[model samples]
Target: MNVPLRDPNIVMKLSRLGSFHQSKLSFLRSFLKEFKDWDYKRDLFELNEHGYGIAVYSFKKKNRVYSLICFANELDENERSDRVIATKWDAAFTLFDGVPAKQDIERLKNEVPKQEFGRLSFKELTLSRANKSVRIFNHVVESLSKGVQPDRELLDKVGYLYRTTAVYGSGKFGLADRFRIKDRKEIYGPFRLEMMLVYLVRQFTFDQVNHVAKNKNPKKAVKLDPEICRNLGIGNSTGLGMAPFIVNHPTLLNNWISARETSLKKIREIKNISNEEIELFLGCLKKSIKNITSWNTESEYQIKKIKSLLSDLNKFIMYLDKEFNFKQDFAFNEMYLDLEKNYCEECIEYVVSMMMEPFDDIVTPLIQEMSSEEGKYFNIPTERTVAELKAILENKYSEILNIDFSKKENNLNFWFISKNKEEPRLANRFDENGADLEQPLAIARDVKKLYDLLSVSKNSWTIAKFLSTNNELRHVVRRAFIVEKFPYSEIQDNTIGQEIMPIDMLRLKLSFFGALKFDPRSDKWLRICMFQGAPLPEQLKNYDEHWVYN
Candidate 1:
């Protein structure tokens, strides 16, 4: 309680946020912990010899049942693409509200594979489609059919057999909106249902691959080793489609970062360290080395980060073993200070995650706090005076206010939505044509403008009076008030600057989703693996909470 939370200005920086690692508060890990006791079943798996058919999996507890209806289809090697325009997918999946009947399956069979072109009824909660990582998928199939396990090194290299291009929910494509199911007890956490769908899809991957292998050599084939399956995960290729989300949802972003900061703050406040807790933290830290060392990426940007993380982690390990004393008071606080002083942002944040591994009592309660009722903070305080609004801008957005937006490079980029996909994209403002239609994702720049306008406004005038004339800055006005209450609400950087890395934005969100092995394909898009080394469906009931490091 004595140690202060990290400054929001420092924590909400794109560079620091981009360095975030998965922790206990991550939705996927929390999803597993929350629903582990539910009964899991292969409710309907009707795959053909080539593995093209409908399969359904469910997790049921009492009367509540959520089903994943999967439609695996044959795709030509040339047709398989992770692009949004690719109409055909190797498989399409939807998380159903309850068990899907034969008639319901038939209904979805016609529409699910059609993806964005199709309509999903209110019963479906989330929709996603993935293409095979053909080389890895076939390698697994061939190895299994030939009566052997796939090469461990190869499996380790690729990490997954399928890579999802998109996952949609919240009224998109006519699926059930958040308001419809937000009150569910099990889904109190944000993206819980999406996490559920993805987790179940992971199981489907193992099942489908094994089915195809068995069909290929009915007599000799063996199922994939559960050990190997445990190591594998679902891959995803994310683009700028996700970059705007962090900007668009300020309260939600605050909740996510606030949860992480609160956890770290609480952990650092620990006055005494138990020997057991120390060992658990160190054990997770030591085992997590493989996660860093095995991270594969061709992006020189990420390669440098990985190497720096590994080096700092090793240095930290040596310090812990040879010099640091757990018997000291507020040991975690002391260690955190050391990391901040001596390590890269990646290493500092990675250890921040490991620090929580030993403190379920600290992290568990915070999981429920990550989701936001964003609407609660939507209204601007129109009654407040211009003086108060300007004070907020000055106090909370100090870093943002300092950005020189008049510089051409600082104003070089714009965010816009593509017509066909309705996805957010980043473009060069000078060279690209859509600067005129740019979305208001330029939070820092706009906030700066709001500050400038406030500077000349009468201090005695209420915001209601100010807005009546300067209404164009209303969105940033709303956000400034939101940021006043939710400290981590806005990013403290120039989003449209020439040096901006949209991947940093995507990486921040993906880390919260518990994604691993982030491979930046470009500054605008990247690949990631989810549920890597997570427990399988059947093992859920008794899975280790720290499976990430195991």
Candidate 2:
């Protein structure tokens, strides 16, 4: 039996997209799987009593080596800030293309810590900065120095000792452009290097905390238990800076969503499932409950969603344990339909991700297809007639066209780039003064305007002729053509709407990164944990693939 892929119109809405969860295809999980056989080492460790110095770590396989050069600095309590404009952080790091010599380390010492202000050569593949969770960091150090493990409760509350403010790659701040290393087989999946940087950073936090503890009391201090270290992953604080990425990378976004939809379709098409697959799926679903129960968040918005998700998951579990039978044909398809009919968007998407856990064959191949050669789709098909473009817009952007842009609520917000930090920001169009300089991120509004203009234009006129006069709509015209082929390419909602939850955009991207425990601080920013409960570098060689649930 063949199952149809989920409709893009329903899946592409911000709320549904925001409801996405990490699956086997998430970049970090794939990154770990790919590098499991590679050599892991602490090539250099030269920190002082205060853990203020340089450290180097590497993952090498055969001739290729990717070294992470870390520089830890002492910062006063007042100096640490997670804002993008902040100049100082507890630590800074860069993933060097290869092993660094003394001179190379010295060169990076003066540059990596400076972050955006400092220039990076092509040798640097990814750069990032992180601030310590001072309260948690200090508590762990104090407990370890006193010959006791830190309070696991406290550790679980805040999952990491350090939280990176930003992780930069793809030629940002003069870093190496993607073309320089895009062909690397190991990194063919998106953000593999960025994952490497964060994973290695997780180790650095462990090493730094241990070193500081040992220094505080040489004889009694004990090493942190490896189990504790594994549970504590790196934290990341993300802001609206990630919101515009989906709009700017239409083809890439489509590839990601398409891969997910395809995976679901293939999984649901399976007519028979073995007992082992059923056991694995059931086990993951049950173990994953801890993740939901322990998900701590103060944001009422997130809390309500979590509550609904947990309640629905419990209901599904009761049905699975009591009424559901694995002997049924196309069982997953039936399960999916039941989920959609009974659960909220969050629960349905959550179970969809969980369903992929038992089918690596389906999810593994889709991972490579997530990255896009976006340039191939950039040029508009101007040779086509104006009527063709209008039809494409009308069909591809049906819900978008229905929005009444003239309503103040529909056109309430504007997105603009901050001149100082060069980051994307959202503002009220009515209350703020920057609507004139708004970025071209309001795709729904602009597409509607384009449709109104095209309604009266000559149907036979070629797009080239139409664009010659209506050049302002050329961007959306290119997008319309692209979306004609990539159904999930365009979001079906108004981005500038007054009720828009900007965190939804960030959550969509973060989910692909394999981040968990999304703790939204506001509508515009959130905190997430990565690589938590993942195997350590030393254990990667023969680790359990199902460790996510473990």
Best candidate per lDDT, number?
2
lDDT of 1 by residue, 1-550 (tens): 5888899888888899899989998899999999999999998889999999999999999999999999999888888878888899999999999988889999999999999999999999999998889989999999999999999999898899888888899999999989999888799888999899889999999999999999999999999999999999999988998888898899999999998999999999999999899999999999999888889889999999999999999999999999999999999999999999999999999999889999999888988888888988888777899899889988998888888999999999998988876678888888879788989989889998888988998998999999999898899999988988999888888899988888889989998999978999888889899999999999999999999988
RMSD of 1: 1.3
Q: Per-residue lDDT for 125 in model 1?
A: 94
TM-score of 1: 0.98
Model 2 quality (TM-score): 0.99
TM-score of each: 0.98, 0.99
Q: Which stretches of candidate 1 lie over 4 Å from their true place?
A: 419-422
Scored by TM-score, the top model is: 2
Which portions of model 2 miss their true places by more than 4 Å? none
Candidate 2 residue lDDT tens string, 104-201: 99999999999999999999999999999999999999999999999999999999999999899999998999999998889999999999999999
- Steric clash count of candidate 1: 0
Worst 10 residues of 1 by lDDT: 420-429
Tell me model 2's lDDT, rounded to 2 decimals: 0.93
